[model samples]
Target chain A: MDVSFLFGQFLGGLTTAMFLFLIASGLSLVFGVMRVLNFAHGSFYMIGAYLAWQAMQWLEPTLHRFWLAALVAALGVALLGAVIERVLLRHLYGREELYQLLFTYALVLILGDAAKAIWGTQQLSVSRPPLLAGGLDILGTTLPTYNLFIMLIGPAIAVAAWLLLTRSNAGRLVRAAALDREMLGALGANVGAIYTGMFVVSSFLAGLAGALVTPIQSIVPGMDVEIIVEAFIVVVIGGLGSFWGTFWGSVIYGQVLSFGILVFPSFSIFSVFALMAVILIVRPWGLFGRPIR
Target chain B: MSRCRILAAACLAACLAPFAAGAESTIKIGFPMPLSGPAAVYGAPVTKGAEMAVQEINAHGGVLGHKLELLERDSKASADEAVRLARELIIKDNVDFLVGTLTSAEAPAVSTIAKENRIVFIAPTSKSVQLTSPKNLHPYLFRLASNTDIEGHSAASIIAGWKEVKRVAIIAPDYAYGRDAVAAFIGYLKKARPDIQIVDQQWPKLGQSDFTPFITAQMGTHPDAIFCDVYGGDFVTFAKQAGPLGYFKAVNNRLVDGGEVGTTDEAQALGADYPYGIWSDAYDPVIWAGDEPPEHKAFIEHLKAFTHEKYGSGWAIMGYSAIVALTDAIKKANSTDSDKVSKSLLGLTFDTPVGKRTFNAKTHETEMGEFWGQMVKGEHYPFAIISNPKYLAVGPFTD
Candidate 1:
């Protein structure tokens, strides 16, 4: 009956979309260049939140700098990502895609349990840095300051990633590989290094996304399931291989979430899933996606 | 040939001693809890409490001269898996009785199956009111833990006493537990204070990390107080994100209700300043001060020692009470039969870790009254320092 309520719902959906994009981009990068459908991608994001919370606790009393902690957290996760890839994932590259998917999927179980062990089954969170704790008080309605930070971070990361991919030789190799993997190998490129790089960057993106949202969500063990499920939804909806498509898909998803709640309180979550199903039936490869096969 | 025959005789005798001991030993109770899984943090302590109670009872000349033997299975807070484990314990392990299914959801599944098989089932941590209701129509089911009704009444009692609380806004997970809790709480409050207005109510899905929208919507109403019934990791998330938005601090008063908040450690982990001075209806997580009842003092000191020796937390207290309730029923019943045990459980009077517990035949569930406390130190062990809180004993509903 009311149009303004409809508009409010749209904004809510958009906010949810922004977070989904951050998760899907990294997942798509690895899936695009390498054939690994890393189910552990969600774990990386979960770890990012845990590590940031841990870092914040240690640094808060002494350093008083959340930014410093945030940076260190992101970098720490990146290093952790590289280590995991080298030790476990690297060897599995030549294996079948199903094996890679299954292996990473198994990692989800282990990591989920391990997090429970290390974190003691308690929920932990880092504070939003003092500068961003309060809302901007938009007109009569209030928007969370942390949300604005996330909204900006999503696009900023996209732009930075695009620049890196377009500008650097490493980026060129990654794109070339993503575009044509066998050709890159035939062209005298040591595709193994490229795969490793792509995985590291991808995992790093996951970690960064985790670290960024530390202020806004509590980190817990089973949290991986929730984050990963949402990540897959975004990846599938945005298309399996398109970064920009992932961005738009996230926007669409966020809107679905927000408006879903406003339009029909009972079925907001279901609405997004329904939209995804419709999209898949019409375009199996996703909105802007090319089929990997 | 003589040496081989003698060795065979020795092996048979060694195995038979325990079996022979079982005939003389108290009725063996086979129990399984989530000792090492997602719910282990809660399940492990409960096992300790139950085991300790079983040990204490046995030391006092056993349950009817038969020592209680406990066989525990790890359910890992899963339903199907828990039922499978229950079957293994019943048919394969041959546990004489079943005692626990950690979560509310899992309790019904295992209890339903156990009821069908004619085994007495007891739940330690299940807060769902469904198990004890007459709707089950089976006589073998029992629950030791207090349900949402007790918790809701606790909130109502506090609300009744408060001077500044008028209108309330409610937020809880959209699930059976959440709905039950909200319904019971609202019912109690309405009965206690007819004038209190409920401005807004928000129900978010379980395991959801985002609460900004709900928080925003609640703030718009600007109710004098807010009630949250969501628990576990979700409570932690709600508090953390809501804090950044300055919603809790800005709200005049708030009441947070969660099973996880029963522990001070969980509160501390959310953030040092979490629940941020909010009032909660939870377990009193401290060694009570002043001249206390002898039994209460002894219970507190014994639990402290057990916790220290076993790296335990406060959660072990409830499990300890379950053990107490079970033993009390067994000793009073003076029989080991499942039917007799089920009858003994109904209207049984017993000393419990949370205080005196009495079950109603109508509900088949015992009451462990709430421990109300405010968040203190916000982020530390023993964060909740409660004043002398009341333990209200009420009967189950007609349903």
Candidate 2:
């Protein structure tokens, strides 16, 4: 009700939005260009968190240890995405969309079980880097320095991703392939390479989100499935393939979830879905998605 | 044709042999538990405990001159799956007794099946009071864990002693277990400390990843203390997120968590991140500061060997006690009949690794107590351990 309390709530919403955007952007991009709803995106995110936890174990404790571990995890998951794209996803691209969906779903299950096998079922946690381990007082309310880092990084990643898609050659090629793969192929741009490259970038975003979330959330089994549901909600409400749509959707969702509990304590769980339903009723193709052909 | 007929006859004999031999030599106890997923953190250890009990009993010439055979099945923490498995174990496997189920959701459903089939069922871990509420209570079903009311009352007693605390905030998962426990806590707290004001209550969904909003909002109320029911990985997430925000410092470290966060599994998982001064409860503690009983010491040693881990889990005692109790009931009844076993289990006292526990004849509930203490950095172990724990017996509150 007061300025400080409202501001604190706003910051919390923004922090939630950042995490949602990080995971949803990759999912949206993959669907935009690849036309494949990668069900395994959350699995990639979970793997990233586990990999970072593993990296931290191997590395010496230092101020930059968390950052280094996150980078390692992101790269590791990106490489895994590339391999999966090449070995399995590539073969199913020309088939029915159902096949691709099933393939990705299968990947989710396999990766989930594989993570269990490797990490065991114990929940794992990661400490924030010493530089960002404390808090800062703003508007008479305390906000975690780590959360502030996420809020800043979320926008930076968004700008970087936008620039890659609009200003760079690879970006143009990917956009072209998303519009018409045959035309891009005829123009002598290796369509397969562009697809694989897009998948890797999308995977990197997911992995990064996963690694960053380790300091905030418990890295546990079934985290993959838990996150995928929220990520899917973000993407669907934002407009399936639109980058800015995903961004705004996450922003809306994060705020609603943060404030919903305060306003309607008993119905907070349904608030997100209720907003999604209203959006779908108003904008059937999402806020920014194109109408089906 | 003759050779084919001979092979078919041999296969039939092989299939029927176990059933024929099992009926006379073994008492089958069907155990359905969450062996995978998030709940597996507790479930896997619980199963190991049951296995250890069966092994020890069998080694000691079995119970009632019959080997106790455990038919363990993974319920995956699903209520429907647990019910289906319970039925399958009863009808298909012909298990004479039913035991196991981790979550509050799964236990009640399986209890219904036990009632329908007239088989004695003992729940080891599920603490929902609904499982044995007068409406749901049956002759066949028995609960080994302390129910929500007892847990809540115990928590309130702990909080009431804090003279400085007046305004309190509650945060728990928004479900039956959380709702019931918090309600019970409030009911008791009001009776104990009428001056205490309930400032705020936040019902986050179970397994909620983010607690920042709830934490901030609750802090806005400026309560002197908080009663938290979040447990396991969720608690780990909550503590890590809440720490940097000065949430603990804001409340002056007066968070009394009733979700058994004092257990070694959670303490070890959180490591140094665990809030040291907060009060919590656990069913068992591996490290006993006072003179450790030989029975407990031997149990811990056997558990370490059985689990193949350096440290024994406090959770393992639940399953171990259940099996031991079931076998003891069988020995008392002198038969595997459900009627005899169920009747024998009423008011039955059994020895556990912790201490002797008895099932209440009227309620079909065990008077199980828990160790309440403050979490502090351990001297020997890297994780936190309970400091100067006081055992809160369920008898006073349950009665």
Candidate 3:
């Protein structure tokens, strides 16, 4: 009830919001440009965590090993995304929306099984680097240094992504493609290549989020499904395909969950869905999303 | 004409070979468990334990001259899937007995199937009381693991001994298992220590990756101790996230966890991040410094060889005990008939690696207790081991 306690809760919510933003942003981008709802995005995130853990095992124990492992995981997932897009997804883009949705759903099952086969169903964990292993006491509440790092990185990624999508030539082409693929294609732009590129970038973000979350969460089977549901909710609440909408949506969700626990401890699970339903009824296209043509 | 008659005889022998082989003396037990996914952390080890038990039993001239064979199938930790597998194992595979299922949700459903088929089913590790409650209890269904009430009471008794502790908070996965355990703990704790204040309770859904808000919210309550029931990977995550935030230190490191987080697997998984000094329980412990029983020592040796792991898991003992109990029942009844075996299983006294366990005839539940102790660093292993471990018998509480 006190100001300090409220402030602490807010900070905690912010940390969760940042984590959600990382995963949802990629989902939003993929939907925005390619109109393909990638259900395997969470699988990519899970693989990222697993890869990071494996990489950490192979790498020498050092202060910078955590960051290096995370980079490797993100890149690995991005490469995987590229191959999936090229080999399987490219064929389905021309088909009905149902086919695309089913394809991604199939990927979810396959990737989930694949992860289990590779990881052998044991729960794995990655330790935080020594530099980020401590805590920072703020307003009489101790917050994890790793959580603080995530908070900072989330916004930084948002800014970087915004600059890329709005300021750069590649960004302009991607935006144009999202608006009108046929028009962009008529303008002699490589539409297929742009779609692939967007998918890779989205996958990279998801992978990065997964690798970063390893220090806090135990990497286990079914984590892919757990995270995908939340990420999907975030995207849906923010209006699918709206990058900034995802950012704000995550913020709203994180706070609702954090404070909702305080107010209604037993009903916190329903709070997220209730908020989503309200948002849909009030603003069907999402807060920042435009109406579909 | 003579050559054709000889060929016809040979063909008839080949066609009848399968039925003749099917009648060969072997007792088939259906083992349905989560072999893949997150639940496999417990399921895989449990299956290994059952396999070890089956091997040991078969080596000793079999159970009443019938070699025991396990028909293992992946239940995938879903109740529907477990029910489906149970039917298939009963109808198609024609298994004589059933012994598997790792979760509360799956066990009760499978119990119904066992009831309908009139096959003896021994639940290895599902701790929900609903599995063997009065309304649901049947002649064929039996539970090996201690129910939620026993587990909760065990935690309560442990906390009651801490004279300085007053304000207590609870955090558990928001479901029947968690709710039941917490309710039992509070009900017992209030009777034992009336002065103790129940400060706050947080019900995080199972598989929730984030524990920050819950952690911070509980910390705000300023409780002297926390009773946590989060288990497996979720517990690992909770500890990792809570450690850096000084949540353990703030409560003076007095958290009593009742989900078998004291097991070697959990300790090793969490490693240094494992919250030391937290009171927890495990069904079996591989390391028993001065009080190691010969049977336990031998079992650990076999388990190490079987699983190719340095330390035997506490979870494995549940599966090992179930098989041992089934084989013992079969020996007592001197028959593979479900009715006979189920009758024999009642008031059945069996030897486990930990010690002797008995199934109460009235409840159809095993009097299985766990080794409760505070976790602390030991010189022998990298992870924390139970310090001053005490095996709390469920008899006193259950009766």
Candidate 2's fnat? 0.63
lDDT of model 1, residue B340: 84
Q: After best superposition, candidate 3 residue B380: deviation in angstroms?
A: 1.9
**What lDDT is reached at residue B60 by model 2?**
99
| TM-score of chain B alone in model 1 | 0.85
Sort by lDDT, best first: what order? 3, 2, 1
Q: CAPRI verdict on model 1?
A: acceptable
Every model's DockQ: 0.39, 0.71, 0.75
**Model 3 chain B poorest 10 in a row by lDDT:** B390-399
DockQ of 2: 0.71
On TM-score, the candidate that comes out on top is 3
Candidate 2 ranges with C-alpha deviation above 4 Å: B1-24, B394-399
Q: Order the candidate numbers by DockQ, best to worst.
A: 3, 2, 1
**CAPRI quality band, candidate 3:** medium
